[model samples]
Target chain A: MLSIKNIVKQYAQHRALDGVSLEVEKGSIFGLLGPNGAGKTSLIRIINQITAPDQGEVYFNGEKLNPDHISKIGYLPEERGLYKKMTIGEQALYLAQLKGLSRSEAIKRIKYWFEKMDMQTWWDKKVEDLSKGMQQKVQFVATVLHEPELIILDEPFSGFDPVNAEIVTQEILELNRKGTTIIFSTHRMESVEQLCDSIALINRSHKILDGKVKDIKNSYRDNTFHLNYSGAFPAEKAGLFSIVKPADSENVTVKIAAGKTPNDLLSYLLPSIQILELKEQVPSINDIFIQKVTQLS
Target chain B: MNKILLIIQREYLSRVKKKSFLVMTFLVPALIIGMYGLIAFLTVKGGDKKAQVKVIDESGIFAGNFKNNSSVNYITTKESLDAAKKEATESGEGFVLYIPANIESDGKIELFSTKKAGLSAVSNMEKQINDLLRNKQLKDAGIDPATLKEIDPDVNIDSIELSEEGEKDSSAGAAYAIGFAAAILIYISLFIYGAQVMRGVIEEKTSRIVEVVISSVKPFQLMMGKIIGVGLVGLTQFILWIVLSTTLTGAAGKLLLKDKIDQVKTEVSVNEAGKTIEQVNAEGPAAKILNAIQTLNLPYILGCFLVFFLGGYLIYSALFAAIGAAVDNETETQQFMFPITMPLLFTYIMSFSFIVNNPDSTLSFWLSIIPFTSPIAMMVRLPFGVPAWEVALSMVLLIAGFLFTTWLAARIYRVGILMYGKKVSFKELAKWLTYKE
Candidate 1:
């Protein structure tokens, strides 16, 4: 488990991160969602020990984070830095050793990762010679080669194409399944919907929403329904439920008032029209994300 | 400690394994040796070319002054001055030395050449005429030339030095060689390793690799690893260069001296005897130099030279590391490096003067003891023996200076490694120096 509590970071006149906090459960994929400059990088830097927060305490596996703790945390900063002149294998081994693996151990791990990623041929190639996607593959291998307890990837999927992104996504899932907690930050909400079990959303340096993905979506749900009926229903006859859009002659999307139940909405609409099919619409994570962020602003 | 060693090992291996480092290491010595050989070859080839001379002795006073050598075919002419000048220019005999009547009174001889007379040929002809005039003056005075020469016995004096520890001193050449070796070692090490640090820092910063490395290791560890690793690489190259150069120089020396080996040995012994005689009759600048050379303590000089060389290199290398971290580019480094390098340059320029005036004075003592200036200044002072305590104290101070400077540099490095965009200034560097974390 990774816990970040009340992290506040101030930079001169600006508060980069203000009272931001979140928890990533064991064997879970946690999404750290925020728009550009919404304190995600500041929080990530603090977690990586690149900088210290003005007021915060981070706990990993029930212990306070320290230099020793850093060895168990794999961090891939969003800027995507690597030594351009160094060969792929050399860089991987160097970073692996820095993360507390011995030389032999690091080499073994790097070989395994290389083979797993089908990048064995790239061992002798310099990073600069590799394409942007290939370099990211090298960096990704370096990050997870040591098998840290937690992996924090800031926009890990940015440079990757869809095929490569799927490959990484599968790897992240496999790692998480094998008991590594992953905290991935990105603006790609679809990835969050696909991979994240829970998410923490920060808007303007504050955590405006956080919880299990299902629970957050459930909490933001307003009783709404979509009906596909052959007969037309008068908008006034729909009672307190307002028709957001009338699709074709056979379909209509409707929103009910706050206190109205699904039965109450059905009771009013059934009398005015022949209901062919009526289904409750559960909001998608993307819709909920956009709504939450916009609401906070 | 293991982690530091790991960092050092990684740095050392990575840099040493580089093709550029290997190329430079071998290339520098080869270039230096090639330059020296080229110069020697050119000198020898230039010296072998011969010139012809035509002499015009108008007074009949210096008629026999000309000598016939294979290189210089000297011809005598008693024709009219205008005719001789015209013949000299037209014939293409290199030059005509016009010796006028009463040349000794005139005190100057005129040489006319088609283009220009070779300087060696002109000087040789002048010396021969001057010797003839001197002999003529001696004969005119009613004194036998041989008798005058016999009476003027060359005075010789033997040099003997008593050491403070009751030991007889050896030749002064050893002292000079030791000082020379020490200064060269210090200069080469500082230059090679300092640039290594600069390049290493620039490489990391330019590639943006420092962002990842900084997350795992503090910038201090990284900087120290680079400095130590590069220093070791420099030492390795130095050792290799010394061995290669020594072997090459010895082989070349043998080849060059092969034909004249026996003649050179006999000539050297005769020269030594002549030097003793000259020392006895010594007057003017030569005698002062001989005295200074005699007073030098060769052993102590050599010892101090080694110590100061190591000390000074470490001190300057630390500063270089700091500069490497502070600047983002090599061009910007020049602005700061000049001030840092000035002390070493000043010490080298003023070295001989310092040795002459007062080798044991307060100025020499302080300059030689300070870490920044010590390598050159101490080597300069070493020839005129410093006290044992002063050497020990200087070593201690130099070590302390290295340690303190390294610590200060590491502090700046920790912050500077990750800093980008804003151009770093002295004022900003001062602020970083005071930053506690």
Candidate 2:
């Protein structure tokens, strides 16, 4: 678990982060969401201790964060970089060792990851010689090579191809499954819904939203149902439910009126129409994200 | 500390492993040796260039007195001056000397030739005519010409350097060469290794690698690692050059001059007494040169060299790293570099022109004591033998200089490494200096 309290970071002319606070539960995929220049990177950098905050305290599992905690954390910056002239294996080992791994351990873990990622042939190839996506794979493997308790990846999938992105996603899921806390900032709402368990949305140096992913979606949901019917469906007015035009021609979307349950609507419409499908429409994370961001903006 | 060592290892290994480093290391010493060999070759061959002179002395008293030597072949002619000039122009290989009948009263003479001769040739003719005239004057005055030759004295001042220990023969030539070489060596190494440290820093920042690396190590550690790493590379090349040049100078010395020297010794040995006197004059300076070199406290000099070498690299590289971090690319670095390099360039010129010539002067003394110019100026003073206290003071100031600049540079580097896209000015850099880590 990680807790950031009252973090304030000021640049020359702008305050990159202002009085921001968030808590990430242990072993959860925490999505850090923000628009451009919203202090997400500043918060991430503060967490990684790349830059110290002007005034704040970061506690890891109830202990104040210090240099010792560096071993417990791994950070992969969004704009990935490696020594262009160095071999892939050497570069990986160097990064792993910098995170406090022993030489032999770094080498072993690097080899295993390279093999798993189908990069065994790239061990001696310089970073400049590799494709951008291949380099991204190497960067990803290096990020997790030390097996830290918390992994912070900033836009890890930005330069990755679709297949490579899926690979990264699966690896992140596996790492989280094995009790690793992950913090990734992304604009990809689809990925947030698919992978994140909890999220904190930061906007303009302020924490505007924070909760469980399912709870946030559930809270944003209304009493709406997507109804599809066949044979003898009434086009006329209904008493219990209001019919809304479906964006598509074949399906009809309807909202249940107040003080009405799904059973009331089902009973009201079952006699006249053969219902092919009936499902409650829960808001996706994308819809909740856009709606909240729009409201806040 | 371990991480710093790792960074150093990476920097040092990456550079030392390059083929360019290997080639440059050996090539520099070889080129220097070849240059020295060429100089020695020219000096010996230049002395032996054969020349001929046809003398038409109408004065008749000096016709047979001008002797013939292997280097300068003389032929006394009876033809008129006009006919001799014609012959000289047709020949186009040598000069025709004209000594008129009134040459004894008027000390004027002329050389007529189609081809231009060097000043040494003209001076030789003057010496011959002057000696003949002088002997004739002594004979006419009823004085012994042999007694006058015996009375003439050649003044050779035996230069002795006085120290607390005692008097020792001094060779100005040796002192100048050694001092100039030391100063130049420091200047070159400072520029080379210092720039390397800056380029390394710029590479990390421009490529955005600093953020990832600094996540685990402090910015100070990274900077020190790079400075020390490149310093080691410079030291390695220098040591190799020293060893290689020593060996080549000895081998090439013999290889370049053995046959020519033998031929000159044999041919010029016919005038045994005159040639032996010339050798005595040359031998005195040569022996004094060896004595001067022997008086140099080499271990002491080497110790001071090592200290100032690292000290100079550290001081300059600290600023270089800061500049690299502040700017986005190499071109942006030019404006910032001028201030840092100004004093270095000034010290270099001062070492060559003023410091070595007058090491005991007040200006040279102050230049040696100042930390910024001390590396070159002090080394230049070292061969001339600096006082113990001044040497120690300069070293202490250099250590202080290293500490202060590194502290200042670190403050700037910590903030500048993370900055991008902005054109940073000196004002911005001054502001960055106050930023906390």
Candidate 3:
């Protein structure tokens, strides 16, 4: 669990982050969404303690952040790398030790993770010898090697292939299930729809929307309906309700007016058409995302 | 603190295991030994070429006086000047020396050869002819040649160094050699190791691993770890070089100069028994060198060398590491590197003249007190016996200098490591220094 309050960072003439705030809950997957140059990285860097904010306070588990919290927070920067000349096992051990793990404990955990990822053969191989996707996995292992309380992944899935991406997704889910708080920034709204429990959308140095995914979708719902009929055509007034899809004998989708109730609409159309099915349409998170971003921009 | 150690361990192991490190550590001493061996080999096998000199001697005062040594042969004959010159060119064997009839007054002669004669050959011929002409002149003046030879003296001034404790019969030449070598060694190691620290920083920045590293460790810790680790690498190489060179030199000396060294040892022992009654030259040259080495406070020089070497390295390497962190590539490093290199270059050149010629000069005293040049200047003066207070003051200032630069460097490194994809000017760096930790 982590909280950042009123973070402002200034770089030369550029205000990288202007008065942004965020909170990451325990045992939940939090998606941080923003467009390019939206100060997502500046916010993340403040949390990771890479660079201090001009005016802000970061709290870890309800205490002021300090150097002791470094071991508790794991950061995988977007532009991350390993020492190319150092072997995988050695570099991992060195990094793990830097995170406060004892040498023996580091080696044991590294071996387990390497075996689990099917990367045991790369233990003695130098990082430069690996392909981009393979190196990403190693970096991932390094990020989570200490089993940190909170893991911050910046663009974790960019360089990975689809298969590797699936694998990483599963690993993230697994970590969340094990009670590790996760905060990841990405542009893939589809993935966020599939995986995120909560999200904070930042745009143009402002937090426009943030809440539980299902609740936010509920809030952005449009008055729409899907209908399934058995026998006849509904001789409804063309101006009353807009037919959303091409007419079908067994099914139809429609958008009704805001003032009308579903029961009132059903009663009004029951005599003309044999009514069988009626369902309200709820927008997808992607639709809400696009709608909200366009509205704010 | 423990993280710093881990970082240091990683840096040291990663570099010390490289193939370049091992190759250079061994290769340098081998090359040095090879060069020294070549010089010794050439000296032992002196020139064996035989040179012939034909004299025309129109003066008629000297005949059969210019003789032959092992390498040069003198041929005196009563031949015409034209015949001698023609024979000299066609024969292709030697030179034709023409001593004019006015030689006893003029003190000048001409020699003709196909190629320019060797310096040693010409000087030998001149010595032989001049000796004979000088005696002839003395006899004509009615002054006995034997008495004139008795009065001719070779100057041998005994150089005694005056010290606060007492006078010491110290060898000025030996002191200069030791002082010069120590000063040069300090300068070379500082540059070598300091550059290594900069290169290591540049490597980390380019590789982008520093981002992840600083998340777990402080930037100050990272910089200090790297500088200290690389310094250890340089120290390791230096110690190995000393050990290897000593072994190599000893083995080579035994193999090539066994008979010569043993002969000198026996003669050295005989001179040692009569040292108090005899002048410095009465001892063999080798014996004098051995005795001078014994009189030197070698342990003191060595101890001070270790102190100043590390102090100087720490002070300069902080600047180098800062420069490395400020720039993205080696090309961008040039602008900042000039200011750092100027002082080092100044001291290296000064070691040959200012520091060596007068350790007590005003400029030398100031140079030895300023932290930038003091490491070399102080070492140069230390062998000649610096006052204890001056050495102590230099030590204090050097430590302060290292701490100051290290603190400044860490400030730059803390901000600069994360900055990428931009040309960082000096103004940007100056702004970074004002940033808060």
> What ranges in model 3 sit over 4 Å off?
A10-15, A225-255, A259-263, A266-281, A290-294, B47-116, B261-296, B353-355, B381-385
Q: lDDT at B53 for candidate 2?
A: 83
Point to the candidate with the largest lDDT: 2
Best by DockQ: 3
What candidate 2 gets wrong by more than 4 Å, as runs, is: A229-259, A268-276, B43-48, B67-71, B75-92, B106-108, B112-114, B141-146, B149-153, B258-272, B276-291
Clashing pairs in 2: none
lDDT of 3 at B315: 92
Across all models, the iRMS values in order are: 2.1, 1.3, 1.2
Q: Second chain TM-score per prediction?
A: 0.78, 0.90, 0.84
Give model 2's TM-score versus the native structure: 0.91
Q: Superposing all C-alpha atoms, what RMSD in Å does each candidate have to the true structure?
A: 4.8, 3.2, 4.6
lDDT of 2 by residue, A1-297 (tens): 999999999987888888888899999999999888999988888888878899988999899989899889888988568887789899899888888999998999998998898999999999789888998898889889999999998998888889999998999999999999999899998899899999998888888889999898788767889888876556534556777654344477888887888899888778987788999999887777677788988
* B136-223: candidate 2 lDDT, tens digit per residue: 9889999889898788896777768889879876767787877787888889888888888888888998777788888788888898
